[model samples]
Target: MGKVSSAIINTENVYGDLEVAAKASGVPVKDVDVDILAVHTKYMIGEGEIQSVEDLSIFDNDEFFLNPELHIEQSYRVRYYDKTVTEKTHLPKIAIASNKTLTKIRAKILADSEVRYTADLADELENAINRTLLKYGFLIGVRSNNLKNEVRRVASLIRVNGALIEDVIFDVAQGIEPLEPIDDAMIYHYKNKVENADDPNSSVLSVVSENETIIEYVKSKPGRNGRNLKGELIAVTEAKNENAVEIKTTEKIRKEEDDKSIRYIAISQGYVSDEGGVYDIKEKLEVNSVNLKTTGSIEAGLDSDVTINVTESDVLKDAIGPGMSIETSTLNVQGSVAEGASIKARSVTIGGLTHAKSAIESVDADIATHLGTLTCSGEAKIDRLEGGSVRARVVNVNVAVGGSITGEEVYINELNSNCTITAAKLVVINQLRGRDNRIIIDIMQTPEYAKNLKVYTDEKQTLGRELHKLKANLQDKLSLINSNTSSVGYVKKRIEELSATGTEAPASLLNKLKDYQSLVYEYNTIAKHYRTQKERYDEVIAILQKMQDMIFDSKVVNKGRWVELNDIKFELIEPRKSICYVTKENELARVITIRHLEIAGEHIYEIKKSNEMPQELL
Candidate 1:
């Protein structure tokens, strides 16, 4: 037998050619055998033989090979040689085996162009590989360089998963410059871009994120009725000034440690504590008003005025403890104050009743207390004050009982008899005269009243001196007028005698008559001067009398309102007895007697009827 050459063909049409060649070579056609080898590397490795073709047309020439027998030993040897070469190339074998599986995936990814290979697909591939490798007593080491190279090569043909794509995106993100946050009304779209670093035409861009925001503006879109709502519309605008970003979130998340909820809304520049309290306001904290509903207290720092309104009762009891004080520039409290709580501020006003033992001190304080003491440097207006002392520059009380009130001006609608009142200027009580009430009116000894009295006395003395001088001048004028009148009468009698004589008298006699006539004129002039002086003297006398009356009135009602003691046997404590002004004969007069008076000093005085006075005293 000669050496037979064999040629492998991947098409089924060549099988008939081999049969005809064998028959023409004097070999029997029945000896020709055609074998089709499936071109898949999995089937090519195990048996070194062709598998059966289930469907003839389904097998493509590129995926299947047709092998015909030459019957010579050389053709058989050539077939064995080609199989050995295919089995030794492991990389190409793996690629060829996975090609059909990867073709469908690549086509799917390329169809969308933006489709990303996700981590789930990569995980499935890893799991399948692990399961297959484990059955062969081997494990796929993910960290191996050979596997990494193979995966990169395979991914280049197909599409890498999302995990790798995300890595690339992150790298690009790190290189990008950070952008300033925009707070205006605008639309922004963030895109993922792939650019050839070298070729601008190779760039691709796709949107990754999009955002739209709205802000306030002056002129905005019209409403449904074509009417411009005052503050409802929003317009597109740009930020004018750049400042540090401030994020104000109204949704407050309370800490787990706190047992209560605190809500604070700030409309101005102010600092709110994490615990929901406002303090340390640099400017005046002006809101509609501060209203506390629960158990909370507000404290304004120095120079900050605060107006607090608490509608709930017993809410401030725990906040304002005994001896604890709330101080502010101006404090306005509309709730009841706890007992023994002291408040010191520039101005304090309490709309509710203050409890007992609470001391309030301010420049101007207005409070209603059951038994709280109020000390105001300026003015105090109290309502229903009972069993507490009040000392202020000016005090006005609706009702006072068993409390010592001392002020420059004190006004009480109803004063209990057990209360002691001391006022420098005035004390007015509608209902006075309860037991043991000490009403002390310090008048003459008071510096303010004493100064006024001194002024009055000096004026009266000066007026009296002017009156005496005028009277003296008038008296001299009267005397001169009387003398001139006598002279004038004598001159007039001589003139009449001369006229009756009707003869040419001596020049000396005529001159004497003329001198007498001049005397008559002088007398008339002196009479006119005397009358004018008498009128001035009378006016001065009237003024002097008025000043004397005023001096007496000043001793009683100089700086304070004179009390009308309405038949009440209440003891009056006065600095001087004469300071009491009593009504007698429809006129106000100083007390004259010490009868029925518990006098502290020797100047005690009493009031008496017109008939009760002694004959000499009247």
Candidate 2:
């Protein structure tokens, strides 16, 4: 090839609507078709400036408006570039050749001009070499992606004006060395990726579901011998790898073999563990303790079919260290949990004290001592609680101290410290040893009560007003229609009489008839509106009353004697909270009762003290 260069034919553009563009380009209306890679459009936001891209997605949003004009500058890229060397002056001498068998390809930039390289140029170089290889008996052994990469390297060196690349080895080989394995081996394929522990988002413990593919086994086949350029058979002198091994999995990992291949699946959802080159999915992972050095973050997940057990139980060490989180199907801890440590599972049991800053969420929880945030959907049994937030459905505590307890039903054996207790239906305290306590009969989230009740109450009032107005409006319309009935009858009779004599009725009589018909239609519409609004008002009133009934079912009771110096306050948290009562400075009582009632449109909270406990607060 001769010296080469790339050139653009023209840069002119024809821009306008269909007819205007045809006229500008001097093309006939029927032949005004234009060929372009893309239509350039501008999208603007507000009046400040035009913000757009070649992509039309930017203008797809309703916030951006289309501009009338397109951008003037057109971007261009070189697709195929090449230059032939024509007696180059101070450049390095180029060299290239084919081996005796034509089974190797080692070459460099043997041309002159080279700049930006592209896929087209890479294809040209590969196709030329393929033709030469096809002429002989040798065939290409290097992959297509790798071959193109090497071809582009030639352009890379020319663009940098750098030193020559070594041609001693096969850069893009015509045929790789012919070899065969001495013995066949089993190849195992893992389904999941194992990431490094240092990666913050890395899930070092790969999890798998029951009967899921954890490893696949396929028999390795020996490579076929190759032929040289002269059509000569080549022997397999050297082996790729002489190692041959068989699969050996633990009892937890089940292996199934078919006619085609073999696959190892997990018996249960668990962590992928390996031992002595064998694969096994451990259903239960037991560790002494969880910390940065032991287990960075054990997150097997709630549905991962894995169980985590922390066995360390001394007071000095935490079962789960600071900032450690364990999410599994089942969790058990024998020792205390440290600050910033979290445990989440289907069921959690902590045998030691929980740090104040940590948080635990589970379906069922059993903690010896808690000073952390524990939220459960099922039940919680705590030995001692102090200065932490606990919310569950049914809470049973032996002794509770300075913390907030919320549930559907709460039972505390002894109230030894100041605490805030909120229960939806019932609250029972066996003993009140300290003071400054708030026992609230919580109306919030009391199924179909609280916010829904308020909504229905307001709706009932509005509907009542509307129904009254509609009834008055309907009556007025009916009265107007009745007053014009006789006039309408007289006008219709006069028209009929005139028609019998073959005479046209006066326009005044016709106007009176039409006015009466319009009044009747208006009256019927108002009557229907009044009836619908009255039914809706009755429905709203029923719903509001039902909600109020549910709210009153909640109660708070003190079962044991109230300490002499203790101050306990009872509260009801309805939409409008009501303070039931606050005991005297040195109040003494056996069993106290607090109830909510609405009499004469007033919320009456009654505090009755008795020696007997309230039966409803059981």
Candidate 3:
């Protein structure tokens, strides 16, 4: 038979009511006989569901489309399942095996077979439909609408009319679709890194402050998964943002991740940079020079974890601009520091001269040449010092023309300085020149020692007074002993004469002589006590002298011949507190040194000239 389509006769095949559905969907009905299965409903419902639909006169719906074959095959060779359809990234689809779809009418079958229909017949039809769907690898949905009612309604029609009827529905093929990512990851740069380092204007580098945000990273997500009708898993596709810029973090820049994004921040003050998707915050920075034209003043703070290296070596121009101040953890300058500039750091190194008006402060410093104000808590080494005011723990200079230097220990190879020098330990110079120089040895250094010295000095003065009193008492005692010596001899003679004669002498004379003898014994006891007190006084004096001995411990040694002299002098500071004071006025010598000496119970600081120098100072 040729392919045919049945037109409904008054009866409609929509899921709900025939009359209402025809009017709503704009279909012609309620005219032909022997109802034709021509009405098509987009959404299928349970059988006879149209009976209760109250006011569905103007409802609209959309129909999902799927291809159907020309005719239905009912043979043993018919294949119900199509395997060519597969699930895509976000869409899953399957094909229908047959062109026509029809619902089995239980009542029609009963009427044709001359058997009475019961509610059990509907159950049987549903069972059979389920079996068919299972055979085609379909697992969920569709059957939830309950096909029992559909079967019973068809059976009711057959019982009333006593004829078979056809119920048809077109099913659109659908399956589970895989989940897909919606957006891609992105990177945003907050600080633009220098692309070229060789640029001439890069004399002084620009740096980002600590804890500044460098980059913001927006992360991507992978969506959820899905399954198909065949019970197979569908994996989700990850989002790949091709246009998003990628920036990697370096060690100097720490990364912090939150619920949504990752942040790159500079942990130290330094040059922030990005190169080929790599982000870096460099703590070590190199600049050609620091001036108003090239770069502004850099004050990142002393503890900013930054090291700056100035590479400009021109002696004519300043490495640090005038009136500019720099404070960093470490600073190295190859060129001269200009006037009115100030530098403070943990460590400082200068390859060129520091000008007069500039000032530098550091824990430790090394300067090629210095003619400025400098204060160092640690050691300071200078190639040449001239007319500068410097103070440090230990000062070493190759050549000192003129400078006011104060240090615990000062060592100079060549000195033509007319400036004042104060050191606690000693000032040793290989060659001396110029005049108006006053090298002083500072005795008061450590506070604890100084305080103890003061106490001992007071004790020493008291002991000296006690010793003077003891001396006067001992002189009187000696005179008594001298005067009583003749009398004691005469009494001894008288006692011997009496003993020889075995004669009884007067008791009064003997008693008087005996009392006279006790006087010498008493004098002997008092002399022993005086000696002990004198020793104690000497001990106190020694302690006081040791405390003042640092002045003598310090010295000014001019090892080589004096090049020139004009009222040059060397003096021990705090003369009263020192064990001995050294003095020199316009004294010219080849090798001048102050020596501590004891001559005739007197302390002396002897200034002498010699060629030999101390081996330790060498």
Candidate 4:
């Protein structure tokens, strides 16, 4: 009997449903008998034939077969609770039992203690050293040869006993050690901090400005009296050399009223023309050519057309003529601006030329010129101006001087002047209401200007009479209240005297005392009413002052417009006329209602009954 293999069948040896089991097991589903085997086993007291065997192995020649399948396509299945086959790893088995006794003693010691080690413990120690490095988190830096010594040092510490390395020791030597898994947040934060602190040449500049501008300085540098070019580069203006350019405040050229007095006066020269002045000279003059230059003044004399060229130091009076040309580079002085003379100059001096005695005078300038201080003995007129300041005794213009003009009586149609001025009429101006920043007083002429007069006849008379009447009534009431209260004290004393014997006070005396009490209460009421009336009387006097203040503070009033009291409060509500007024107190407490009327004048109606009217009412 050599080792034999056979597929034995026993019809009576089936355990589960044979057909269903065969179908599930991917074998032929035909009803076939399974193999039965007789074995002596502890599970069965009496050994007989075992019913079924789950696994069937059969050998034919040298090949082995598990279960014969009927279907050509086979699907394998296994049933178990959470059946998972363990994957075989190529990692070698850790054999601590090579020196069994020593390994057992070490294991026993470690089990009772906190230390533990595994097959890749040495590799873990090496990785810890690399992990401690701040830059090793970067893939390139970690693989670099820079941290090789550190890794080797950490590997040497992988002994069975490294004095039970405490967390504090590791914290001091290599920072917080990264254990099994590194926390992403801690790693990222530490990496950023370390990189920021380590980079020496890392310099950055940040600027914020709504308007575009350039910075010309920085606060710190690198050496000697210098600073650490570290910290934030907030603004360059704090550090290096300051190269800010300062603006020079030279005179800004503004449009000015023309100042040259070129009147064609007909003077009585040589008895030919009695009124012949510059007009006679102008008839004989001819313009050679009109050439424009920047400097000097032009004066057309009797026969030549004047072309003025002002220089740094030269007077134009001697060199000007009709049709004659004068040219210079720098302007030092402008020719005398006199009547009957036309002056075109780089600048002008009006100090020598007195203003014309004409009712109206006009001056015009095309280029830059100055009219120093114009003293108009009478009156003058001016046209368009480019620049300069004018101070005139009496200045009047056909059009408004667009620029500034300072004068005693300056008349302008359209211009912006910045100064103290006194004019009979200032029609159109903006921000003329004095500003606190600038010292300017705009005293507009009041429409009811007559009311501002200092005549106090009406006010004094009215106030004096009211004050006298109020004082008299108040004094009389005070005297009467004092008399009645004194009488009440006397009556009380008498009643007490009568009741001294412990008997009730005489009825007559009690009646007299009750009368005194009534008089005292009436006195108090009258005193309170008089006080209120006195206060109201004072208010009537104070209202006049408030009305004056309203003329200035309120725009509606200050605009010099007529505003009736009805416009202030549009709707008027009049109390119902004497329709048996009902009041909270039925003990004859009078119900006074206010009735407002808006007629031609403001009036208030009193709806008091005839009996309730004060005896003092007229």
Best by TM-score: 2
Q: Across residues 54-99, which tens digit of lDDT does each residue of candidate 2 receive? A: 5533322212211223121232121111223222123333334566
Candidate 4: minimum summed lDDT over ten consecutive residues — where?
A: 100-109
Query: Any runs in candidate 3 off by more than 4 Å, and if so which?
Result: 1-248, 251-254, 265-278, 301-305, 445-545, 563-612
Candidate 1 segments exceeding 4 Å error: 1-302, 314-319, 443-618
Using lDDT as the measure, the top candidate is: 2
Model 2 regions more than 4 Å off: 1-204, 217-246, 251-262, 445-530, 564-575, 585-603, 614-618
| Lowest lDDT block of 10, candidate 1 | 167-176
Report the Cα lDDT for candidate 4.
0.28
Q: By lDDT, highest first, what's the ranking?
A: 2, 3, 1, 4
lDDT of 4 by residue, 464-542 (tens): 6765775676677667657777666777787777678677777876786676666566657666765765566566556
RMSD of 1: 37.7
Query: Could you tell me how far off, in angstroms, the CA of residue 201 lies in candidate 2 after the best superposition?
Result: 8.2
Worst 10 contiguous positions by lDDT, candidate 2: 72-81
Q: Judged by lDDT against the true structure, how good is candidate 2?
A: 0.64
Give the clash total for candidate 4: 30
The models' CA-based lDDT, in order, is: 0.42, 0.64, 0.60, 0.28
Error of 2 at 119 (Å): 41
TM-score-best of 2 and 4: 2
